[model samples]
Target: MNISPNGINIDEALEALAACTVWYPDYREAMRIITKCINTTRHRKDPSSAMLIGPTGVGKTRLCRMIEKDLGPTQQARNSECDKKTWPCVYIELPESATIRNLSVVMAQVLGGKPTDNQSVVILEDFIIQRLVTIEAKLVILDDFHHVAEKGLTKTKSSLCNWIIKLLNRSGVAFLISGSSSAEETIDLVEELSDRFPYRAKLQPLPMADKASTSVLLGVLASLEKEMIKLGHLKEYAHLTDPTPYKAIYLATRGNFRRLSDLLHDSFEIALLRGDYTLKISDFAEAAADLAFCCCPNYFLMSHSQLNFALKFQTNKSSETAKK
Candidate 1:
C-alpha cells in the first residue's frame, strides 16, 4: 500500500477524517433547542413534542445520539439508581414500512417487556405506557418519521398520533420525531398531532454564494486540516479555503454536510496514495464521479476527467437499469 511522506497510510488518514466532526452553527443551535425541549416537557401534565426536519444524512440522528449520551444510557433499559428507577431517554427508529402494531411492540420491548404478535395492540400500548411511567422516561425520539407520509399509511399514522398523545398525557414524556421534508407534511395532516409538535427545527444545506455560509464551509475545512495535523498526518497547512479548490468542492457537494465529508474522505484516499497531504480539485472532482448523487444538475468546473467519469457512471447505471 502507498504511504505519505510522514509514513501515514490511507487507512490511518481516512480514520482521522472519520474521527473528526465538523460542527456548524446550525447544528449547535439545534442542540440547544432539544435540551430545552427535554427540560420544558419533563414537568408538564400534557407534554408537547418537537419535530426536526432535514434531508437524510443531515445529522439529525447524531443530534439524538448526543441527547442519549447526555441523559446516560439506561442499564438493562431500566435500572434502579439512587433507589429510583429511571430511563432518561429512549430512541427508536421508525422502519420504512412501520405499522401501529409493530411500533407498539417495539415500544413495549424497549421498555423491557416481552411483547408477542399474538397480543392485542391495546395490550401492548398499555404495557408501554405503564412501563414508561415506572421508568420515568423523559423523552422519546422517533427517527425516520417521514415513512408515515408515504402512500397508504393513513391508518398507521392516525394510530401512532393517538398513541403518542396518550403517552404524553399519561406520563408527561415528551417526544422528538425527525425525518426528511415529508415528515412536516405528515404532521400537518393531523391537527392534534401537529399541535403537540409546535417546536420545530430545520436543517438546510449551507450556501456557497453567501459570504457567511462560505465562511462556515471554509471553517469546517480548516478544522479538518487541523485534525489531520494533530494526528501527525499533515506537516504543512492545507489551505483548503482557497477559491479554486473550495469552489470545486462546493459545486461537487452542493453544500450538503454528508457529501462534503464524503468528498473529503475520498480525496484523502487519493492524497494518501499520492504521498501528499495537500488536496487538489482533481481529487474532489474524481471523487464526485464515484458518488451516487449523479442526478444533481450542478457540475464542477474541472477537466474532462470529472465529466467523463460522471458520464461513464451514468452510462453504466443506465445499462444496469435496462438489464433489470
Candidate 2:
C-alpha cells in the first residue's frame, strides 16, 4: 500500500492493492524446508519428498503459491528456433474424487503435454518421467493431496499415491505435498509411499499469549495500519497493538493468518464505504459475524459476558494474560 507515487498510477491504487501479506515466522520456516528439499532433491539416494500439513486458514495453499512464484517463475523460452520453454517446477492440485488415470492426465497437462490416445497408467508413467526429464524440472508440488483421500482409503486411491511416489523417485525430482491434517491418514494407507515422504511439517495457528505470538499478531496489524496511513486512507494509527483491541481481534480470528486477513479486508472495505479509514471494533465484529460457523455479535452490541461467551476470549490460556 505504500508504493511510490512517481511513474505510478494512484487512482485505482486502492482497488488494485491487496491486503498486506501475512508473512510470519512459520511461513518462512516452511519455505526454508521446502527449498532445501528442492536443492538436494537429485542428490538423495531415494525420493526427496516432504509433506506440509495444516488445517484450514493456516495459509498452506498460499505458502505453496509463494514458493511457486519465488522458485519457479513462468517458463522462459530457451531457444530462438522453436522458442521451447523449460518448466523447472510443476504444481498440480488434486481434483475432488481424483483417480490414478485422472491424476496422470492432469500431470501431463501441467507438463504441457496432452493426454495422447492409448495412454494407460504404465505408458503414462514413462511419458511423465520423459517430460519431467526434458523440462529439467527439479520440483513437483502436489497441493490438496487430501482431496484424493477424502473418502475411505480405497485401493484406487492408494494406487494413485503410489504412482506419485514412483514418479518422484524415477524422475529424480522433489515432490512436495500439502494438504489438511487428514492427509496424514491418506499417506499412511500406502506405507511405502509414506516412507518416501519423510520430511513432514505442520503450520499451526498463532497464539495470543502476552509474549512473542502476541507481538507477531501486533506486528501484522501494525503493518496493515501503516499501509492505510501511506495510502492516506487513515489519519492516524488504529492502536491495534493495544491490549483491548488486540485481544478482541485474536479471539475472533483465533490467531489464524487467513482469518485475520479476511477480518481486516472486510473491515477495510466497510471503512472505505463509510468514508472513513478508522478500523473500529464493530468493524471486526461484523467481519467475524460473516465467517463460516461463526455466531459472534458486534463488539458494541454484545455485553461483556455475552462477548466472552461468544468469542471464548483467549480460552486457550487465561483471561488474565489476554488482558496484557
Which pairs clash inside model 1? none
lDDT of each: 0.72, 0.71
lDDT of 2 by residue, 79-198 (tens): 657765677778899888677787788888887777876888788888899988777777788898888767644776677777877897688777888998778778877888888777
> What clash count does candidate 1 reach?
0
Worst 10 residues of 1 by lDDT: 294-303
TM-score of each: 0.80, 0.82
Candidate 1 residues 1-324, lDDT tens each? 656675776676678777576668888788777777777776555677888889976778878788888898775442465555578898888876777777777777877789876999888878888877877788889888877656456676666677777777776788888998877777776788788887888888765543535477778777876776555455544466765555656666656877877877876677666665565556655666778772254454454467456555755886899999
Which candidate achieves the best lDDT against the true structure? 1
Error of model 2, residue 261, in angstroms: 2.0
